[model samples]
Target: MGFDPSRPDIHLGHVVGLRKLRQLQDLGHQLILIVGDWTAQIGDPSGRSATRPMLTHEEVMENAQSYLRQFFKVVDRDRAQVVYQSEWFGKFSLADVIGLTGRFTVAQFLERDDFAKRFAEHRPIAITELLYPLLQAYDSVAIQSDVEFGGTDQMFNLLVGRELQEMMGQRAQQCFLMPILVGTDGVQKMSKSLDNYVGVEEAPDDMFGKIMSLPDEFIVSYFEYLTDAPVEGQTVNPMDLKKRLAEEITEVFHDQQAAAAARDRFERVVQQRSLPDDMPVVSLSTVSGPRWSNALVSAGLVSSVSDGKRMINQGAVELFPPSGQSLKITEDGRFEAPEPGTAVKVGRRRFASFQE
Candidate 1:
C-alpha cells in the first residue's frame, strides 16, 4: 500500500483499507508500507479540480513521521516493513528519469478523469502530475508487490502499477479498491484539506462530536465500514442510530469509558444546551492581545482566524461574559477578547472556559 505524506494524519477514511490489510496479515501476508516521500512533491492528481501544490522534502518527511503511530492502530508496526521513496528515487539520475517518463505517453495520462476534464476546459495540467501515476507505479515494481490496496479513486494509479509490474517481467498485482468514506459535510469524500474529516487521533470528545454532526443518512455506512458492531434496523430513529454509531466507532480508537464520557459530554453540551462539565480551558498566559480570533485558535475552538470569523458571522458562536450579557461579533464594533472566566460556545459542540 502506498500513502503519500501530503497530509500529516491518517483519518477514519483510510481505516477501511488498513483494516482489510490487517485481515490479510492475519492470513500471513507480508505488508510492505510504501511512504511516498518523493511523490508528495509532485502531488497526486486524483479527484482534483486543478494542480495541487508541491511540498518540500522536509515537509513531506515530517508528515510521514507522524503517520506510523496512527497507522499502527489498525496495522501492526512490527509485522510491517516500512520503506520511503527517497531510499530508491534519490539515486536516480536525469537519464534515468527521462527513461522512466519515456515508457508512458501523454495520451495515457489524459485518460484519467481529472486530466481529461482539465484538458477539455483548457485548464493547466502540470508535467509533474502526468508523472505521478508512473512514480507510484514504480513503487510497486521496486517492492515487487503481489497485491495492492487503495481507494476507488485511485483505480487509475493502481492499474498503472499492475501494467508497470508486468512490463518489468513481474506478475501483475491484483488491485483491491475500497469504498471512499464520505466526509461530515455529506457531499464530499473525507479529506484532511476539506476540514470535514474526523481524524483518528482527535480527542475522544471532538471525534464523538464530529460523528454526531454527520447527516442521518451516513449513519449506516459509517457502521458498515468503520466498526464491527451491527446497526439494528430502520425502525430505530436516525439520530439515535447516529449516536450509537458515534459510540461504537469512538470505542475503536478510544476505550469505551472515554467514548461513553464523550457521548455524555455531547448530550450535556448539545442536547441539554449546557456547558460540558469538563469544557476545554483556554489559557490567557501567552496571549499578546485581546483578539477573539487568537483565543479561538489557542483553545482549538476554531481552526484559524478566518474560521473563527466565519463561525461568528454565521451566528454559531456566542460569548457569555461575566456580566451575564451575551456578546456577539459585529462589524465595526468592538470584538475584544473575553474577560477571564468567560464561557465561549462555538456551534453546539465546542466550549472554552477562558482563564488567566
Candidate 2:
C-alpha cells in the first residue's frame, strides 16, 4: 500500500514500514503488498523536491520483478498477498478520473508540505502529478486495506488513502508512518540515486563491509530497526551495536556460516586483526582469466581494479603459493597456477582460491 517501486532495493526506511506490516501479519491481519504499477507512471511527489522521471512499462515490469525477489527475503512470502494495482488504476476512464477527483479539493492538495514548499519556491508541480495521492488513495479503497503504511515523508499520501476510504463509504485505514533511515552519507535518506543503499542481495562479505563502513552516527538507528536486537531500555556502545546489527542483517540474507565468516573477515581486515581458519572462500579457475588483480576483481573480491591495486600497494594483497607459502603480490604481473590449495588475499578481507 505504498509507492516508489522503481528500485527494488529496500533500505532501512522501507524496513521500518515492512516491519510494521510483518507485525500485522503476525497478528493475523490481511496484509497485501500492492506493487503500485499504475501509480508509478505518475510518480509520487510526496517527499520529492523535483518531479520524478517516469518509467516505461517495460522498465517498470523488469524492476518490479527484481523488487519482488528482494522483498520476500524479509516478508513471509508464504502468507503474503502480492498484487499489482494496474488492473484497476490502469483501466480507469475519464469519468473515473473525474469522479475520483471530486473526492478532494485543490486547496487541500496545495496544503501538503512538499507541494507548498515547491509552490513557495516556484517549482513546477505537474497537473498529472497532483493526482498521485488520489490514485494512491484509490489503491486503499480498491483493496479495502484496513491500514496503510508508509514513511514519515509519505504522510500526505497515506492520509489521502485514509480520506479516500472514508469518502467511499468504507472504513478509514490507519496511517502508519515510519521514520526514514538516513543513508550511509549520514545526511540524506538511503537511496539508489544517491548510491548510498546496501542492496539486500549483495554478497555476504560485501554486505558485511558496507554495514561496517557506516558512519558512527547511523549506529543507533541501524541497531533499533535493521537488526533484531532489543534496544528499548538498554545502554549500549555504538561500535558493539553496529557489529551486532551487521551480523543480524547479514544472517538474514546469508547462512549463519557465511555470516560468521564475514564477521571474522571484517574484524581481521578493518580492525587490524587476524583471519579465522574457517573464513569464507571464493573459487577462481586458473584458465578463467589472467593476472591476480583482474582475477580478484572478477571474483568480486575487490570493489574495482583501482581498489584492488590500492590494497595491493598497501601490502594488503597476499598470494599463497603451491607449497602453502604466502607472498606479497607485485605490479610486474605473472599468471601462474597456485599449489593444490593455494589462495590469494585482498586486504585480509577478501579471499579467492586458484582451482583447475
Candidate 3:
C-alpha cells in the first residue's frame, strides 16, 4: 500500500499496521512504502476535520531523513522499496488530476464516514479533500502494489485503491486492515497529538512503565497486536501477562540486556517489594540536596516531576541505605541517600537503585 513514511516518529499505534507488513516481508513478498510527501500536503481525509496543517518542504525533507529508521525494527527493510509520492504526484498534470477524479463520483466520496460525518454537521469539506483517497489509490496503480496494509479506520481509502487498480487495467491490490490499538486512555485511538502515545524513541524503562499503567482489559489485545509473545488461551494473570508484553516490545527497540534490567527492576519494585541489587548508578558531581522527586527524574526513573510526586503520594517511592533499612520519601520532605546501594522507586513499576 502507498503508506506515508514521512512522519518523523513512529509510535506503538503504527506498530499494529507494521506487523502486517512484517508478515508479508517474511513471506518473500515485495513491500513498497510511498512516503506521502504529496498527499500529506492535501492531508489524509480519513480521520481529520478541516484540512491538516501542511508541512513545509524543509519539514517534509527532515521527516523523510529518519523516517525509515524504526521501520526496520519490525520489517526486513532490505526487501522493501521506499519511495516518495512526490516523485509521481508532484509532477501530475492538471489533466492527470482531472482523469483521476473522473474515475470516482461525488457520491462515493460523500459515502465515507469522515466526510459524511463532517457533511452532516455542516463542517467544511474542500473539493481537494475528495481527491486524497483517489490519489492514494492512484499510488497502487503507479507501483502495481500486490498487497496493501492499513488500519481498519482507513478501509474506505484502502478500498479506493482496489477500485482504481481494476479500472486502470491492473490487478486489484488486496487490502488488509489491521485492528486499531486504543490509547492509554483506553478510549480513543492512540495518537501523538493526543499525548497518549509511546514513541519508538522512548526509553525502555519509560515504555515499560507506561505499558504497565494500562487497564487490565487491554493486556491481551496488546499482547496479540504489539509483541511477538503468545497470549492465546493462557490462564496467567493479566498484570503478569502485561509485563511480558511490555518486555517483548522493549526488547525490540532496546537491547535484550536493557529489557531484562527493566523487567528485573519492575519485579523488584512491585512484586518482591525489594530493591534491585544491580540497579544503574548515575553520578552527581555535586549534591545540593535535590528533592527526591528531582533525583528520580534525573535518574530516568520517571517521566516528569509531577509523576514523581504522584509516586511518592502512592507510597511507591522507597529509599533504602546500605544498612538494609528502608525509608519512605513523602511529598512534604526529602530523604538523603544514606549509603551505597541506596534505592529509589518512582512508582510500583519503575525504580532506580543508586550508589554514590
Candidate 4:
C-alpha cells in the first residue's frame, strides 16, 4: 500500500485501492501504508505525458499529513502501519545508491510503457525518473511486504517490487491491481489535476452532486468499487441506480443522516428547481450593469470569469428574477440590474442572491 503524496487530497479514484487494503486488513493482514516522501521528489512517471514538477520537502510532508488524515476515512488506522520512505532512503550512501542502481539496467527501465514511449519519441527522460521504480521496489524489500496493492497503471512498479524482493532472497510479493475509476467525464481516469475527482473530504452536498453528475453508465462501476452495495443480477433505471450509488457513496464518507439531507437539498434545489432555504446571499457593490460572468465570480459561484463564461456558454447559468420570468444566460452577456430579490443558479448545486 504505497501511496505517493503527490497531491494534498484523496479522491474516489484512490479509494478503489484503499478498499482493497481494507479488505486485506479485515483478513488479519498487517497493512503497511508507505508514504512516498522520497519518491515524491522524483515523481511517479506512470500515465504521464510530460515531466512532473518535483515537490519541495515541506510540500511533500504537508501533502503526506493531509493524505494520512483522509486515508483513515476508509481504512482502520489502528491496523495500518504508516511509514515514510525517507526512513531507509535517508540512510543510503553513494555506494549504496550505486549498488541499488547496478541491480537494474537501462533496458529494464525502458521496458515500461511510459519510459518506452518517451524513448521512442526522443523525449528527455530525466535520470531521476528512471530511478523511481527502483526506489519503489526497494521499499517493498525494506518492508518485507507479502502483498502490494495498486491501480492497473501501477502494475509495472508493483511487479518491480516483487522482483526486487525475490532478488533479496525473500518470497515474491503478490501484486493486486484494481480497475481505475473513471472521472465524472466518463473518459479519463478520475484525477484532481483534471478537476473531475470527487474528493472524500468534499462537502456532503458537493460529494452528492458530483456523484449525481456522473454519467449513467458509471453507476455500475461506482457501485462495485466505491460502495458495499450489490450490483450483480440487478436491473434498475439508470437514474435510480445513479441516485442509489450517490447515496451509498455519500454515506460512506458522511453519515446516513448527512447523506439523506444532502439528497433532499439536491432534490429541492436542483431536481425540483427550488431554492435552498439556507443558500448564501452575496451582495454586489453594483448589482446593475454587471456581466453575468463577473457576477458569478463576485458571488463565489464559479472560480473565475473564464469559468463563469464557460458555464454561461454551456447554458448552465440561470437568472431567477423575483418578479419576471427566470432566464438562462445563454451567452456571455451583461444584464441590467436584476430584480431586488433575484437569485442566480450556477450549475446543479450552487446558488446566490444578488443584493445592493
Model 3 misplaced regions, further than 4 Å: 232-234, 270-356
> What TM-score, over all chains together, does every model reach?
0.91, 0.78, 0.79, 0.95
lDDT per residue (tens digit) for residues 1-356 in model 4:
88889888999999999998898899998999999999998899998877889899889899999999999999999999999999999999999999989988899889899889989999888988988999999999999988888899999999999988988899999999999999999999999889899999999999999999999888888998988888755566787778778889899999999999998998888789998888788776644236878878878899888998999999999888888889989987665667767888998888888876
What is the full ranking by TM-score, best candidate first? 4, 1, 3, 2
CA lDDT of 245 in candidate 4? Answer: 83
- Give the clashing residue pairs of candidate 4, or none: none
Candidate 3: give its CA RMSD in angstroms: 4.2
lDDT per residue as tens, model 2, 12-115 = 55676777677778888777989878677778787789998888777777778888887777778887988888878778899999999987899999999989
Please write out the lDDT profile of model 1 over residues 95-212, one tens digit for every residue. 9889988888889889999999999999999989898999999999998999999999999999999998998899999999999999999999998888799999998988999999
Q: Arrange candidates by lDDT, descending.
A: 4, 1, 3, 2
The count of backbone overlaps in candidate 2 is 1
lDDT of each: 0.87, 0.76, 0.78, 0.89
